[model samples]
Each structure stands twice: as structure tokens, then as C-alpha cells.
Target: MHQGGKFIVVEGGDGSGKSTQARRLADRLRDAGHETVLTREPGGTASGAALRQVLLEGSLDARAEALLMAADRAQHVTEVIGPALARGAWVVSDRFVPSSLVDQGVGRALGVDAVEALSDFATAGISPDLVLVLDISDDVSKVRRASEDPDRFERESEEFHARVREAYRSLAAQRGWVVVDGNLEVDVVADKIWSVACERLEP
Candidate 1:
């Protein structure tokens, strides 16, 4: 078992398979005898869920949307993630600060530095110990997204998603985040993520 709980975040553009991989990783960790808590951004806490509806369903301005995301994150970290970590439970989040950076900062043109600073303040310096970025081509993301009911971000133009993906790639490169090939089959992607996560988990 780890001395302290670890925070793991899965990030990707729409339809890049973040949810699936996050669940699989959490399950794998639990089966290995680690206590794990699986959660998601913008919907983890009661207040955050309400904010998520507004952010995803309402026609808010880009700045408003970004602020709302930060608000949700603050609640999530305080109410759910922070407590879990304090008690020694590994927290696996489907999306975290990186999503705000790419979706609002880059895709909406608010600037990455500004979003990063806001997110840092909102979470009070809490950050993921590992960030797994599911990297997929734009074409693949489009095809995968076609089957789902589009959320506010999913309804964005192809150019917007391209920018989001590029920003994720750039951030991952600069931050040394693990980038997984999301175009592969589900089990293949899960195996890859699990392998990488195992390396990061403390014994």
C-alpha cells in the first residue's frame, strides 16, 4: 500500500475515451488491493453537478464557462477529492485541471496561463500525481463523437477540437504527462494505461 493516497487524472478531448480508461484503471487498482475513489469533474459534488448542468447546457460566454468550471473544481477538490486523499484513498478523476486548460483556455481562446493560474488558486495547489492524456487523431475523435449526444464542447467546430487536442499534446509534452494512444481497441488502451499506472503506484 502507498504511504499516502495518490491523485490520478485522465484527460482528453471529447470522445477520446477518458471515462472508460479511468474506470478501468480504478478497478484495476482496487483489484490489486488498493483503496480507490473514482470521480469526475464538473459533477463530483452536489454543487458541482448543478454547475455542470449550467456549463454544459446553457449558452454562457467563454469566460463565464471557464469560471464555472473552476467553481465546480473548487467544490470537487474540497468536498470529495481532498477528503479522500486525506484518508489514504487513491483518487482517480476522469478529467481535471487539464480539461479546463484545453477546453476553456485554448479552445475558447482565454489563454492557458490564465486558466492554469485560476485552476491552481481554485484547487488550493492540489494537483494530480499522474496525468494520463488519451491522444487520438481528430478524425478518430469525430467518428467516435458522432454516436453520442453532443454536449456544449462536443458541439464545437472541428477547429475547436483540433485546438483542444493540440493544447493537450503541448501541455503533456511540457509537463511530462503520460500520453496513451486512444485510437486502439478498448482493452488494448486499458492495458496500456494500467501498465503505466502500475509504475506510478507505490508498493
Candidate 2:
């Protein structure tokens, strides 16, 4: 509705319904008459799609993972997010820099500040207008992914997921991102997300 559109991101642990909640919010925003663009990290664009598999499935050290994540974000912003926001279309992303911050930064023991600097360079200071961090426990994350073959990150031990969860909570609080209970029912979580969006961004 404004000159430059808003950028909103949904983040959480595995099986935290990030994709579902992101789509619902994007749809809701579109229904409200805002031009919305829904996308995700690791595969939001042509090049990113190619990187997605390797990033999600490949065995890489923390530094390598962080670099790849940043590269994906760079392309994602340059190709998809930048143009949409510049043209006044809202962008709703499932995951963004925060994923790298928690996953490789904390979970992989690379440090948040280090990954953040990398992310900032990748995004070129194009930060989200609003960030919705969905909080869920490691057990919930494991249960949700039990039926499917695990990805590189998912295959990590329970301790890794626990650390990732804690990092997300801590960093989100430090950054002023809205924290939502992802363990709630989908509809309930969606409603909460909508309310927070309305309350904070009035979108």
C-alpha cells in the first residue's frame, strides 16, 4: 500500500509449519488487497533452486554452510525480493537470514555475529519489515519430521535442534522479532501471526 512494499518472514525449527504459516499470511495479505509475493530461501529463484538441494542435503562444515546460505540469500534478494519490494509488492518469505543465523551460526557453532555479518552482506541491508519467529521444541520438531527422510540439518542430533531452538528464541528477542507459539494449532498460529502483523505493521 506504500511506495515500497513490506518484507515479512516466517521462521522456526523443522516441522514448525513455517511454510504453512507463511502461505497463509501471504494469502491473507493478498485478500486484504495488498499485492503479495510468497517465497522461500534455498530455492526462491532459479539459481537458488539449484543450491537448495546441496545446501539442504549436502554434508558441509559450518563455514561452508554459512557461505552457501549467504550466497543463496544474495541471489534471492537480487532476483526476487528487491524487485518486488521496489515495485510495491509485499514479500512474504518462509525463511531468511535468521535460518542461517540459527542453523549454521548457533547450531553449527559458528557464532551469530559472524553469520549475521555474512547475511547483512548478502542482503545488502535489506532486512525484513517484520519477522515472525515460530517457537517449537526439539521433540515437536522430531515428531513432525519422523515420517519423512531427514535433510542434512534434520539428520543432526537432538542436541543440535535444541541449540537451534534456543538460539532462535534468544536472537529473536534481541532483534525485536515477534515470537509465536508454533506448537499451537495451524489456524490458531495463523490467527496470531495475522494479529501481530496487523498490530505491528498495520498490513
Candidate 3:
């Protein structure tokens, strides 16, 4: 049987540098001879992009937000992620199910178990082979976001961000996720993530 491609997920808060690291990992993997597809949640597909706008810009109840995220995820996996993996292209995503678990589950106080169940159904059982969580302090996160136009989640109160960070830490510990210090310089953080990805996914 032909071996399918690996699925890797990079997760973190708004300013935790997940996008940068995800791109770096994908680039490194491709340079090393592996076909790589670098994508992001809430907007990986056309339909997903529409849903992302509603979820981020429109004000909705927590339940509604969670459901929208699940909806986007379903399309993302079906349309983009699954096909790439089937073709033996490594899929490196900026955010995956973990975002729903933290944002809606813990941050929104919607319950992690329920959110996880929804996420499982959304992705149709597709899960990341390796999850790299860029961990950063609340202070660092705030500093990083200060210069940018805050998004819906970024504009959330400090308590909410704190909850999200703690939830990430808890999930990382329980799930054996590879956590990197996002507080470091971009290149340094990327190097650490690259080292782990090479060892686990490429080696």
C-alpha cells in the first residue's frame, strides 16, 4: 500500500506566531523533498473563507461561533486537506481542531468535551499526526497584538486570552503536543519547530 502524507498542525493564540512557523515548516519540508501544502483554518477553502468572515466579523453567540468553526472545518478537510494527503503531500495547517477546543471549549466556556465531539464530527475523524503549539505568555501576546488591528478574538479581554493560553497549555500537556516558546525571535522559534518536524515527520 502507498503511504499517505503526514498531517501536521501548528496551533497558538492570536499573536503566538503559528502562521509564521507553519509556513516555515512547510517550506523546510518541501526543500527537503517532501511535497507540502501549507494552509490555515477558517479560510482554507472558498466556502471556508466566507464562513471565516462571518465568524470573525459578525457578533454571534458562543454556540453559533463554535458551529461555524465546525462548518468551516468540515469543508477544509473535505475539499483541501484530505485530498492533499491522499496525493502524498504533507499538510501543514496553521490551526486545526485545537483552536476550536481552546477558543470555543475553554475560552468561551462551552465545555471542552462538547467542542471536541463537534470537532471530531467536523473533520470526519481526520486528526493531526503532529501538533506544534507555540506557547507565549499573555504579556507577550498582548505586546505582539498591540501594533495590529485587533480581530474579534484579539480584542477579547485579558481574562479571555488568559483562559485560552491556559487551555492550550493544558491540552499540550495532556496530548503530548510539542510546545515551542513563541516569545523567542521568529527565526529561533522556527528553528525549534523545524528540528522537531524533521525528526518526527521527515526522518
Candidate 4:
């Protein structure tokens, strides 16, 4: 059974409910007597926090963006994820390698193979055991983020977002990750996520 030291990554485009679902699933795992560390990419470590602000708020070249994201991931895995997993704790991250693969790789017109290679190098081959992709439409993403102040990536052109969303779908399918419809009701979505986790991670 997939128990100790397991790393589960929840991935999606903006407004796809990945963060909420990741937190809920991690909590459920903890409640079920698992030592779970709920975390997120680009902000998990202290160095990563500063990198997250620059990555999210400031504009940079596509290559720079990819490199910065990789830097954050490096620090995050080294400081937080690696230690937590080494001590027999399960780590559930809100986003991980897939986000870069879609955002910088597809959305920013960078090649997926290159971004993936960079990410793999950054993480030193440490990869997720499970990746749950919460999928939603572009319209839904816009509506859900309407009231919030848009970040650099969030303020990209609609076409960019379209590509990102499509890339997420394609990549998730290619990687055999679970694709959950994020248009469902919150409770329902949570139930579906939890059910899948139970099936896959439980003995």
C-alpha cells in the first residue's frame, strides 16, 4: 500500500480548486491517522516564499520564469518536502512539476520536454506518486477570479490560458493522472477526490 513518505501533487489551472481540494485531502489523510504534511510549490520553503512573490507578481522572460520556478522547486524539495518525506510523513502539495510543464512549457510557448527536463533536474528525480488534475473551462476560471487582483500569469491573454488549460488536459492524460471535473459542487468534488485517494492510497 502507498503509505509512508508518499508524495501526492494536486495540479490544475487557475480557479480549478486544486488548493482547496489538496488541503481537504491532506486533512482527511491526517484524520485517518496518517502523518500528512500539507504544502505548496514555490512557497514551501523560506527562500521559495520570496521566489513565489517574484514569480507571481513580477514579469520576467519566459526562460527566466521557468528558471525561477525551478529554483523555487529546488529549495522547496530540499528544505520541506524531502525532510517531511524522509521522516515517514506523507506530503501533499497543492502544485508541483506539472504546473511548470503547463504554465511555462505550454502557456509561455516553451517546450514541454525542456521544462520537464529542467524540473526533473531541479527535483533530483524526486517525483510525485500521484497527481490529481482538477480541470475547468476558461470561462469558469475567469469568472472565479473576476474579483481578485490578477497576478502576472493570471493577467495573460485568453489564448494563453486556453493553451495552458489544454496542455494540462493533454499532459494529465498522457501521464495517466486522474482528471476530476472541477465544475462540480464543492462537497461533491471533495467526495470524488477523497474517494479516489482512498482507492489509490489506502490498503
Q: Could you give candidate 3's per-residue lDDT for residues 50-152 as a string of tens digits?
A: 9988987889999999999999999999999999989988999999999999999999999999999999999887889999999999889999889788879
TM-score against truth, every candidate:
0.97, 0.97, 0.97, 0.96
Question: After superposition, which runs of candidate 4 have C-alpha atoms over 4 Å from their true positions?
Answer: 1-3
lDDT of 4: 0.88
Better of 1 and 4 by TM-score: 1
For residue 158, model 4's alpha carbon misses the true position, in angstroms, by: 1.1
Candidate 2, residue 11: CA error in Å?
A: 0.4
- Residue 20, candidate 1: C-alpha displacement in angstroms: 0.9
lDDT per model vs. reference: 0.91, 0.91, 0.91, 0.88
Which runs in model 1 stand beyond 4 Å of their true positions?
Answer: 1-3
Ranking by TM-score: 3, 1, 2, 4
- What tens digits encode model 2's per-residue C-alpha lDDT throughout 37-74? 99999899999998899998887777988898899999
Off by over 4 Å in 3: none
lDDT of 3: 0.91
User: Candidate 2 vs candidate 4: which has greater lDDT?
Assistant: 2
User: What lDDT tens digits, residue by residue, belong to model 1 across residues 1-203?
Assistant: 22479899999999999999999989988998888999998899999889989988899999999999999999999999988988888999999999999998899899999999999989987888899999999999999899999998899999999999999999999998999999999999999998888787652
Model 4 weakest lDDT span, ten residues long: 1-10
